[model samples]
Target: MTTAERSGAVQDPDARRLADLGYTSEFHRDMSLWANFSLGFTYLSPVVGVYTLFAVSLALAGPPMIWSLVIVGVGQLLVALVFGEIVSQYPIAGGLYPWARRLWGRRWAWLTGWVYAIALLVTIASVVYGAGPYVSSLLGLTVSTNTTIVCALVLIVLVTVINLGGTRVLAIAALIGFGTEILGALVVGGWLLLAEREHDLGVLFDSFGAAREGSYFAAFLAAGLIGIFQYYGFEACGDVAEEVPDASRRIPKAMRMTIYVGGAAATFVCLALVLAVPDFGAVISGENADPVGGVLSTAFGDTGAKIVLAVVLVSFLSCALSLQAAASRLMYSYARDRMLPGSGLLARFSRSRGVPPYTLLVAAVVPAVVVGVSRFSEDAIVKIVSFAVLGIYLAFQLVVLAALRARVKGWRPAGPFTLGRWGFAVNVAALVYGVAAIVNMVWPRTPDAPWYDDYLVLLSGVVVVGVGVVLMAVTRPYRHSDAAADDAVRSTAAPER
Candidate 1:
């Protein structure tokens, strides 16, 4: 078949659907339902999330912090339902940006995409940077700040090259990563649970007196970071909607699957690690800063632990690759809509590969710069990455809020999948949960820390939105956008800003 044929532009219902929405199909619809689900699963990467945040969660709230995974999971499932309805109605590439535009307007879409795209880049840097220490250890090298950054740079470049190979390569990489990470999690976690468990299941309910000044409630809320980080990877499914056939129907399922499976895997892994930790007091008292590393070293011994870390490195690589792919599609979508600086160049796709090469370049370059700057102040980089998550959450809430606004204005979702009458309740619940999570994320939890450190997530969000406002006033990129061209999509009752 010709490239266009494979892209679903010839005798394909999916392509016809794209035409109905006023766009030519450019992505090859070769990704199966399994491939689509794998993309989100790999992006979610339970091993990566649980590993990265395990120390922080355990330290802040003791064993009880594991419940944050449950709290965040339930809340994010609501958000996923709202997203499912939106994507089912408008399975547009770039996910949130196009969803917001269709539900609200061009300017709303522009700002939403701006925040989300930048967050994706920063997340890429954060994921790969987290992988740096593991990479250094696996190579039997001393792990230093400079060495970690160098390892991260190498990872970014490698993933970028693989991403440029095209859609099939991306799908294969995701599948391999998904399989290895899941199997690795099960094996290692199972081993810990069966062989090296040092505490009973009841330990989950015990804070072990780790709470600050006997304030258990505050510490518990502060420990919700693990679940927050774990759930958003599901939206990566919808980010590449064009490449997945039957996206309106299948993508919603994939989003929910991403949450359900990712949440379970994360929780299971956490339960294993926490139960096997030789001492919770040690973790909370700052005596066991590397509890996770300690657990692996004990359970798997030296060589076996190295093998497990190698599997973890794969998860990290795939996670970065998935984030990069999501960012590329978002940028490409922006360019295709003529709502970005370099519309023509950014939108251009390689004919043989059916991928946006220039957009991929931007995805790689931004994250590399962020990783490079981390060498200056490693402390600031961590907070910046947290800000990245908050920015993404804000962008997500924009889409949810936009959907709610449309529902209030009498816009019903028309697609292969929807909530029907339950739409409003689910949408409201999702909004409520999302707002609460954001408050918990940005709330000042440290009295001794600098005010900027305490409020970086909130302040950084304001700065990003403020920058978007100024850019909108100057460039007005939305004026050039032809998306959401139908008046039916936007309610007449709501006046455009």
Candidate 2:
């Protein structure tokens, strides 16, 4: 037998699986099941999400806003199931980009990657900027535009350093971050329940009259925005699928588990905060704008609050790290396929570390520049978060919609994970939810504010997608290699069992 044939015969299943999909294994593939889960969990970061949006949710819908957590959680679970099915079959990196390409066509895939890549890079900035106030509070420094911008820049640099440490270090850091976040949630939530319960469980069902229009449903929809934003980072699991052993099977499980664990933790934390608030009326009326900090300080004294904030800071840093890592991988994946400009440099992997250093550098620098925009625009962070949410959900729904189309066209589950008879129903429900999410996210909440400010997310999303369409049409980036694309599609027509 030929030496190449002998090598193929003895190769790991993951390598063979990649070969069957018309690509060779390029990643180190050292991430364990737990490590893979950590990447998703840290990316989801309940602490970061809760802390960042707690005040906004409280103001929008009062205590009942907590229900948005449950509603968005269930909807996201449906979406995650559909994603799991796709990832199980393809098991490639770049998450939605690759799945969209395989299920649809090159143009669709290019747009998906274009939108998603920008969303992820901007998300890193939003996450770091969100963490700035907490870090400032921890350091006894006042949070101003300058301070927040500086802090965000510092965070971006620190995240870049950790990402440069290679996959093993990144995995270890993610696992540690996961532990800290979960433990902090339990300890803080448990303490609030035991010692500082200010209201009964019924408060969660009460809106406390914060629905300015006196319509509880309107308030609930507004609060649902937080839940929609928090559950998404779970896709970070599939973004690194190439680096996980037995990725076809393990990556899907990791994605679902991330939602399960992250959703549960987030729900618990929100409930604890709602039940622990000393003055719900004051919080909702803007009298106590920092409800999370107030609750922490009231439940656990200043020293204890500081301690919890330390854990939260770790969660934020880890979240930024995972975000950058996921973005780099997606960039590398697109570059490897020559879909992006300057693909050669961005696609180069470090011989020793097995990382795309240039890609990582780009990921870090882009966010830093995005964060700098805060200096000129006071509402920049809020608008950017809105843009990130709209962009990401749009990208996610594209894949889900593509999957639904494939289902109608006789796409069966070839991976270990399958939704079986429930797949069709779940896909339909997920698509419905995705459409609703996009509409809810883009709707202007503050009609009284400036037109640009009120409709920032909607306008920005349209511009970004419009730009992507224009670029795709002008560049025709996918026309360079029809033969290779054909080969890949044929090879993956029926993935090996």
Candidate 3:
């Protein structure tokens, strides 16, 4: 039988189990496919993505960042298939953390949760850091270190307030942002492509030979690695499982749609930007403006560029809220299983409405810190955010691999989304793509590449993994056989008001 049919076939377990305690599976299924599509798009706006490509692909891979995006996109597609299988099966807000427990046993599950949690925290920082510069630029004010930090803190507080109100507010806000951002991006891209009709199409097509001052393949790889950030926010949907209207049916659909929407939107924006290829020598020349910032300036003039800047700023802020929402879930998920440091408080659902407030507080820290750091140095801020995002993607890919391994061994989940035999092939492709991206990001490019930045990504990832391992060693509770079963249901299944 198919996965959807299988869910109906399975019997619900007895209600008295401790694992079922206080879980809130209350997400509404009111979100349409487009809303789901925007969930990812809002995360991968043209403004932020352009900077990412310039740094990763153009700076390093020359024109190969385009190819890198293609490679990463394909890998993400396969990985999404894995996510499809899992989300369809579990449909819980906890996402990969719960899946890891079920597939790899509890210790491994907690380990997976640790990595995922840390990744989200880092992503929150990156999002805030990315946004602050855009905000500073749009306001025509010089960005100061203290100002950036304070703004980041404010952004976190704003996001926390929105999340506390729950899913309805987020979905509505996301829909509005998605529409505004998409129209702005298309207009900006259309102007660039149409106005620059005289520019060389050949440059856009054949720029691959123009590698940075490094190994050609390594440059290409690093650039492609950077594109991973373009695809970061899709997982945020999974984090809000408790708030999704019809989570079981909608979550997988939302996830798949997110990839399609983000890929198409990103592709359109890139094409427009590529057609207007700035002087490579000039762009790379010291003191040339941010290529993306420069391009928008050309396409819209000063006034229009600032408008685009505002949109980009809003896009990042949207992502900031989404990141906070996702991180809160991660904390709640970890605490739910007693994996994090403050399970009692962090795990507690509000007595008034059953929301987990303490966990939300914990998730607010990284973004606040990210904002503070951006004022010191934009370059350092960007690199730190990039490093953190890389760690998050790595964790995401690893969990997918672990889950795929279990599925290949004849494990089955009763869900609406299923890959069947194609699961293995798709999953393997995703695994390969993820591995390539990780290596690309870590590989050194040239003597010019800062030593601290070069090692920071590696060190941060190591620290996250080491912490997970240590926690596993100290807890010892995860060794139980029943922990591997990891079945959890809502404390009350009635639909949300």
Candidate 4:
């Protein structure tokens, strides 16, 4: 028996648990429970999601659009439940990649990670670009194409620098972001309710003639897209699980808490902004379509609006930071297992910092390049964001599907968290919801546009995933090193038993 095991000290439970799952604990295991929760919470930043999409939702389906939040929230809660179960069993750093690998196989896991990593990188770019308008407005500057690209690039650099500081700095930043966003939501929503509610509660049921094709159902589905996009990012907790002590148990709770807290905050903020609109019709379809800015300005003048927006800008920055961190961790985890090209370099962790600096650089630079697409055409950026959303949902659904398969094959949960007898039902429901959400998101709304333009989201997602498939086919990674790592872990863990 090992000295530590015989002494009953178990020097590092996290390390031992990782070894059991065929991975090494190279990351700093310093994140507390709250820190883990904060990471997920900030990644699912309600302030950023709600603020960015408020106008779009309002324009699509009016106040009735808020109902999508409840619907998508419930659906996503199901997803979070399944993810909680999986992460509890395999609380590795790469999140879906490692989970899929253990549950399915190398090829499937590689595709899952590839799709998810690409989605995350694109998400960082989308989020940074989304913040451009708010930043420009706060700075009282015109939001030209050049200005938007410059602002997004600057935000990406800032986030990359913070991530390079290591896990502790990330935790600190996430906690600050959580505090600011929650406080902002409650304070702003409450003030809007008390000081600027122009419409009655019944306005929530009004569709505002958005269903021009005579089908309210169609418009509602379109509006539901906003909620679909908002509720993800909770998986960021699982992505960094290896960096947290007692992660199997704690990460599950943190994932669920992310959805609960983030969903409530997003719902409250969206409803507040909807009710606070001084002229709903004008804000929805007329000259002043910026409902968030309009409501804030109406409630507390231009100066106060800018202040609140500046707080939102901070939230945006933190959201981007958390995203880059999650993406880099996923990359590092994949490379560490020899599952990607340049695995040796990408997997190298800084001895002093406990971070994969090369992966961090890739995470930062890719998003910067993506943001450059904004310079070509604003519509291109929109399509890219749509692709990001679709890619993430597709990747998530893949994992859910794999879990269902595992369940059928009699795979049992190995950790403290489980759905018990309800696992099968919840997994099935999650799969159904995930598929429905993906179809809803990818369905083309603009029939009049050119064919290529109309199918932008679908095309973008396919192209990205196709490239990953091609790369996997050509390179066939994980044939040697990953197997060796698994053997090494098993041999190292054998003596502990």
Candidates in descending lDDT order: 1, 2, 4, 3
Pairs clashing within candidate 2: none
Error of 1 at 452 (Å): 1.8
Give the Cα error of residue 113 in candidate 1, in Å. 0.4
TM-score of each: 0.96, 0.96, 0.86, 0.94
* Cα-based lDDT for every prediction: 0.86, 0.86, 0.65, 0.84
Candidate 1, 63: how far from true, in Å?
Answer: 0.5
Question: Which ranges in model 1 have alpha carbons more than 4 Å from their true place?
Answer: 1-10, 485-497
* Count of backbone clashes, every candidate in sequence: 0, 0, 10, 0
Top candidate, metric lDDT: 1
Q: How far is candidate 4 from the true structure (C-alpha RMSD, Å)?
A: 3.7
* Candidate 1 residue-wise lDDT, 8-93, digit = tens: 46577777777777778678777777777888988888998889888988899999888888988898899888888778877778
| Candidate 2: stretches off by over 4 Å | 1-10, 482-497
Shift of residue 353 alpha carbon in model 3, Å: 5.8
Evaluate residue 202 in candidate 2 and report its C-alpha lDDT on the 0 to 100 scale.
89
Residue-wise C-alpha lDDT for candidate 3, range 257-308, written one tens digit per residue: 7777777777777767766766655554434546777777877889988998
Please give the ranking of all candidate structures by TM-score, highest first, separated by commas: 1, 2, 4, 3
